[model samples]
Target chain A: MKNFEQRLQRLEYLADRIKEPDLPIEEAMKVFEEGMTLSKGLRKELESLQGKVEMITNGPDDQGGPDMVPFQEVKE
Target chain B: MHLKKPHVDAIVIAMGFPAKEKAAADSSPLLTVSELTSLIKGNLEASFPDVTVEGEISNAKLASSGHFYFSLKDENSIIQAVMFKSKLAALGFAPSDGLRVRAHGAISVYAQRGQYQLIVQSLRKAGTGDILAMLEERKRLLASQGYFDAERKKALPRFPGRVAIVTSPTGAAIHDILNVLGRRNSAIDIVILPAPVQGAEAAPAIAKRIEQANRLDIADVIVVCRGGGSLEDLLPFSETVVVKAIAASRIPVISAVGHEIDWALSDFAADLRAPTPSAAAELVAESREVLLRELDQFQAVLESTMRSKLDALGASLEVFSPELVKARFEILSLPIVNRLDDAHEALVNSIKGLLADLDHWIALACSIIETASPQAVLKRGFSIVRRVGKTQAVSASAGQAAASRGGNEIVRSSTGLEPGEHLHISFAEGSALADVREVNE
Candidate 1:
């Protein structure tokens, strides 16, 4: 898990690094591919998180009403 | 008198010389068919400015030399017509029997046949629908092949390096194209490759010039154009040769054939099609003012881009300066020192643990020494005594008595008996060496 997290962080860093102008074109292309992977992974995680929240919100409520607030108001 | 003069009554009834006067008054000249036809021809020419006659084309024959002889007939009337080969070939479509046509010319008599005929200067469909029918199939074929597709059409050069114009040298189209191009972009080179544009050989000549220009790589783009004319006059431009030449050209071809409403095959095949030659030149070459404005914009963009690049480079240089690097190192040094201090504490703890182990070993050594010490031997009732002048032990009782009498004395002292040394005798009560006895060795 820690190794995956480290790899994810490194990929994000590389994505940001490729934004710099002087990067070699070949390396930048590789960075773009990696960035795409990271972006896809992050989107998948976000979608899953959203799905979980949706499931919880739709589950066994006293009534299906707009009266209740969803998850925490803030996250770090 | 009435009966006898019945025959003479007729003579009497008629007045003298009255019959002769009536005959003279009724006198008139007679005319033949040829004379009347000449008169009608003269009259019709004076009466009508131009006449169009609709009829079915029949008895059509083109002579081996260079003349066309055909007849135009309606349901009842038939009239002979003649079109010389030069004009017949220029007609584009062949005139044939049963084809309905409207002939534009004057009515006149051919003296040889003594027949009235139409000397047709031009001919076209009597109705507009036939033209549409003729063009439909071609349009469908070209459309299916994607020749008329907007996506396949090339975007005309924004600024052509050099423009080569293919048009008739003597026509108004060349003048119009040159005038527009000159007004729009005077700096652009305009090379005109003159072609006939309207005769039997026009299509092939135009196609050849296009191929020549393409092979020579003379122009960045080409404009094939001619002035507007009647549909038949524009047919040369619509020929398959011209269309294929346009399609095959490597350089972009702009075709401006006729007026806006007139579309030809060349227009479909061209990379860019304009309504007129002047418009085509305008499309490929921009107005001088628009070009100047674009140049100004490009200059501004170039200056701004270079400035931004330089600024970014300078900013990066400042960020990577040695002083900044040193400052960054100093900022991070404290944490590294703190980490090192933590490591030092760990090492000190380990050293303290080793010292504690050494202290335990020292305590064990002390205990062992206590067990093996001479003081322990003393506690065990073991004693070491020395003779007066020698390290000898007095053990047996008789030996101790004998030593006391002669040369040795028994003593319970740290010293032992020695030769020529005096010693005090000590026993359970007392012992002493009183005399010396010489014993056998």
Candidate 2:
């Protein structure tokens, strides 16, 4: 989410800039294309992000806590 | 070590109190009051040099010498005890009436007062004290150290990529948090860092887990939480070590220690505080739907804004004439025409033919419009028919009969018309009157 949040903010800024008036045609095209690319990027990110819960055992030499396991089954 | 009653009796006898030493006054030796008191003190002190006693504190008084004097009593017996200022100060807490305490001291007597007492060497709360006040003092100390400052708190990740929970693995807090996060389908990675949530060792374990989470650097935010419990049970979260650990966390921390009414020190020190574990989970990880909605908004805003920009850019060009653009193309083609002399002539002839074709289409459009024009139709011998004055409109068989009786009505058909009915006939040039002589049906 940290990455997602920062990228979303940047995308919003670019989208706003694309609507800036008096922009040269060439420059507007560049900004517009960038916005479209970012829009696709966000969608791709959304498609890939499925909620996952993992647990790490706290022990010495834990290898950066990467011994990840899903959280216990969710109760109703 | 505990001495049996008979063994204590043996020590007392050795200290010069014989079991059957009573004799006639005339034969018995006389002893001074101080001597008897010293003898009793020695016997008692030697028998119980160090003993631990538990009883409710009564008549508690702090003397001018900074000594704490109190009477500890059970249902049957009471013992006066005094703790020197050194031991009292080391307690780091005040003792008051009605508090049960465990006092450790030696049993002796004051020779001057000729009374027995216990010399208190150390004191501890046996069962209960003002827990709230103690918690407040600790809270104040930590607050002064700026551990609970709003500035020290980190902004929770609006979209947390990973969440770490520092709590007992089996406690209801974990289950509650899991339920909430699960219900929302938070598209975030979660790691449960197991820690004790209650009891004497809970504080240290909780603080240690927070440190581990930080050292691991795996979570974007941390939720330190537990389910509802008694104030005493929640004491660990209020411990200074736990509060400081939450403050020092490199990742954002959300503390949810107990039910809504409980406000632990950890809550104050955390980046965010929720009343319950479930609420903390909800606060830390936004739902997948919410993220999708935000993404959708950005895309929608981008599309609509792009459309409007394009529309504005095309506004000026919308009025340009197509024929003028083609003429400009012809002018620009001259250099190519000059490069190929023979082809230039043929090109000119083809362009001429294209112009002729365009002229023919233009003429055809004009003639089509003229044919549909009312005035042009009229010039070609067409006229309009309309009823004038009082007349019958031959729209229907019944309408003819009804108009013939005496009513003036519009006539579209000559159903039941009598000869010599007046009409208004209009051509493109002028209008005139006419009579219907025959019926056409």
Candidate 3:
């Protein structure tokens, strides 16, 4: 029932938390499960927007484009 | 008071004059034991620099001044050791009784009580009860130079294109990593940067792998790992060279050496530290089931979201459908429609006006053409007499004089020719050829 943006944010937080070194096993598993849910949601959104997919080159800032790229040969 | 006894013994002493002469020589200006001890202490201080001693700590106490007073003992003997507050602060771990320690400091005698003791400058716990103690020491030393700060830790790529593993190729560590990676995710390209994991070559070889990985740009993230070991076996990870190599790596490094309880200095310095080889592999590549489930869930959510939006828009469209509101729309647009009809009528009227103007212009053009017609000129009794075999009109003008003078010309001249050679005459009624004998004007 979570909105896409909200769910994606939660997933990113879960990813970050689980990525820590000393995270407790139980907490990590919880995060892993939550991250799974969030990741699934995000992936669904990504695939749905596949037709509108534009190659986004991550830079130091948020300046990205949905335009031509050499590596854009990757299929949807 | 002893002269009587001395006099009786003197006779006996007189027999040993040589012994008496030796005694006199030995008794001349001899030093007291205290002075001699002081002289030896001064000389010891002047000769030897500070040295380290490894022994078990006993009778340890922290004084009010924060200086530590402890006695270091071997099995047979013990020596007094005092570490001043300044030096004691540098100790990463707390010092306690019965703990074996390696203390570095100068050996000096207490001048007041005259006891030789080791003045500890620094102390480190020896013999590895907690490997983390030594690791903490090394970690502190390296961390102060910014080796393990969170800011320096690199983030691992979500979907790494290539992963280079710096571990023993023969050991279970690599097998575990490879097995996990293959089982979890086989999409990544892996390169084995095999290196020794024990003995003298281990640290250097591990460092070499890190360097080679960087040089080749072979991987997005490098996993420097090995199996668990004792404190001695794990020393390679604690080496400055290996930790520095991990710190200096161009690619992000994942340290997966030793078991969860066994932490090496490289663990702190690396971009990330996995508890074990298999754990590191799992970190690098999530389980296939998880990824697939994630993808499926994402697909469903995305579909549902997009579908909901579409449905909502469709509902709104149905509520405001043009077909349902056509009568109302027509009524609302009645004024505009009437205006448009009036505009159309005006446009037609304007077009009719344009057509009338075009007709007037055409009639005027026809009248002008009729007035300028050559037949009209002929109706006005102006004949266009033309020459035979030529399209030029015969006229009484000066330019036609040459044709008029020619007697055998295709058209006859109005004046008679006084020539017997040839003559031609032409009028509106007919054309004739005649000969003239006499001159005529």
- Best-performing candidate as measured by TM-score: 2
lDDT of 1 by residue, B315-398 (tens): 978987999989988888989988899999999998999999999999999999998885676567654222333233333444
What is the TM-score (0 to 1) of candidate 1?
0.39
- Ranked by TM-score from best down, the candidates are 2, 3, 1
lDDT for each candidate structure = 0.64, 0.77, 0.68
Q: Local error of candidate 3 at B287, Å?
A: 6.7
**Candidate 3: what's its TM-score on chain B?**
0.45
Tens digit of lDDT per residue, candidate 2, span A1-76?
A: 3367777788778777766777776776777777777768877776677767666775523455357677675432
Candidates, ranked, DockQ: 2, 3, 1
Provide the lDDT at B217 for model 3. 68
Per-candidate DockQ versus the true complex? 0.01, 0.29, 0.03
Better of 2 and 3 by DockQ: 2
TM-score of chain B of each: 0.43, 0.45, 0.45
Q: Where does the lowest 10-residue lDDT sum fall in candidate 3 chain B?
A: B386-395
| Greater-TM-score candidate between 1 and 3 | 3
Residues B299-345 of candidate 3: C-alpha lDDT, one tens digit per residue: 44544544554565578788578786897788889999999999999
Best by DockQ: 2
Residue by residue across B1-441, what tens digits does model 2's lDDT show?
244444544544678786576444344445576766677887777888999999988999999999988899999999998888988888845777766788888987888887778898888777535786788889888889899888887887667777888888788898988788778766667788877788998988888888888887878888999987666778899999999889889999999987776678998999889989988887765545576677677777767877777787688776566877787777888777677887878899999999999999999999999888978988899765545443444344334344345444555677666567666555788655677777667
